[model samples]
Target: MRRKLTLKDIARELGVSISTVSKSLKNSEEIGRDTKEKVQAFAKLYNYKPNNIAVSLKNKHTKNIGVIIPDIVHYFFTTVFRGIEKYANSLGYNVIICVSDESFDKEVINTELLANGSIDGFIMALSGETQLKNDYRHLTEVTEQGIPLVLFDRVTDEIKCDKVLLNDTEIAFEAVSKMIKAGRKKIALLTTENFFNVSINRELGYRKALEEHGLAVNENLILRLPFNEQIDGIYPFVSNNEIDAVLAVNEIFAIHAMGILQSKGMKVPEDISFIGFTNGLLSKYASPPLTSVAQHGDRMGELAAKMLIERIEMNFVEGKEEDFRTEIIKGTLIERESTVN
Candidate 1:
């Protein structure tokens, strides 16, 4: 069986960049005539075919929008998708969703696949791998090509575009402050690595709360867990620390810690209270409902969709190209069984 040829393949075969191959094939004047002819000859000999979807999208308005997210399994992301779908549908735009599985390569491929004129604009959340690598060349390319883009939840400051975000730091500070006021002297923070902007903000808030309360910061109590590692991996950290309370950046961490604490003969809200970000199903359905900071995923999605559409419509204007806005959505702390209420 033979495999289909792609720009990447041609670029590799010719010792050129994917961008050069694409431009050469398009008969772009930016590419030298000799190089363009060479690329075309190679493509012709190999029976290379441009993506039909991309070809169709080049000259016509498909009224479709592309949405790229890290993963669909998370409750918060699912809720956000619902919001995007509802608002985009109401505006007579169809949505195409692509999951990157938190991979940098997958994220790049999804954007390249969808950006080929298939969708009018893009709304996305940065994948964990994208954040970790700090490589946003794919995103930068999309914006440079004059595509309307909107980032939500997990976003970067490098790209100038419409963004929807939760005031994670402020809300986290409030949540941690509440715990401190409830007599929790030693609070441990369970979070992902600082690669994630949300986690960094939440950790900063946690530190700020402790400092303002005159509590000593214990570096040993701060556990930076890998994103998707099992709950059992947290046992060592929990066992070694004499934490009076725990604050996790996400519901999964908080719930897992709670289970471990109970198994070790600790009572929820009695021996050690807990709080987490993202008021998702796990937080609500745990053995004892969790107190958490709700990020309002639905609202963020709605705003992201609205912002993208507005940019698409305003794209025709000349001077408006420089205009960009970052909208911060306020988070609310929901009191529940995990905390002293």
Candidate 2:
């Protein structure tokens, strides 16, 4: 079977510019008849197919960017959107936002809706369902067309493009180490399923910290919860375990577990120390407040927007190959009333 050929491949093989190949394929008047024939014949021989989305985007420049987030109500996602909008607007670009609501189908539909030559590029976080399903055909389609995409926070390695991420493992290790230093031995990890890349890294950090501190990682203490749902099993999990510290992947889980434990006569930082990710309003306003990791969503959004815009502009440059990048933002742990100092 013949390997699929792209515009770049055809241009390189025919010793012509990609723009010339693109125009020739469409029989544009800009190309000489002889050159057009040569290009067309080569393409026909290779069974070359043009990506309609790529053709439309390369033919016209759109000063619009599309951003898709998993949930609109989440504080972290909202902050990230703010940063993206702020940076994109400063560059004289309009931003269109879409909420995936943690659904894989919604994410795919949103990508299709925006990839119709409406936007120059896309910035998105993988939806929970998208990660769970581990299918990234929609993302791969856009990238295959040479469209710029930047995934932040909830991201996957299946699709290769630019990405902005938190140093989840390092920060999680720091958080767990702090709890261990505070004389908490039986540390519990409350996280989403391992399919989510961020959760997987954080869990690695959690286990690393426990092992490094001479504490055995107890499987019973690890509670895997469903993403974006009201947690139900926290009470039973806590009641059944002798946990001295809890590390939740997000503020929602930390706050919910703390509230439940407090109602059960547990004192924050004394009976059990609690720490979660994303230092949002819930972390600040929760009873006794919660010590949390600041994921710096705003900075992540700004970086993602910057990368996507750079890629979009670079597409116009002749004969340049895409150089993908992954930018990591360091997270900070905020001390609060929930954890012992």
Q: What is each predicted model's overall lDDT from 0 to 1?
A: 0.90, 0.90
TM-score of 2: 0.82
Candidate 1: stretches off by over 4 Å: 1-59, 228-230, 317-319
What's the C-alpha lDDT at position 289 in model 1? 95
Model 2: which ten-residue window has the lowest total lDDT? 50-59
lDDT string for model 2 (175-256, tens) is: 9999999999988999987888999999999999999998888899999986656488787888888888999999988998
In order of appearance, the predictions have TM-scores of 0.82, 0.82
TM-score of candidate 1 on Cα atoms, chains taken together: 0.82
lDDT tens digits, residue span 1-341, model 1: 88888888999999889899889988998999889998999999998987655654564556789999999998889889989999999998889999999999999999999888788899999999999999999998999988989999899998888899999889989998999999999999999878999989989999999999999889999999886665566889998889989999889889988999899999999999999888998888987999988888899889999999888877756446777999999999999999995
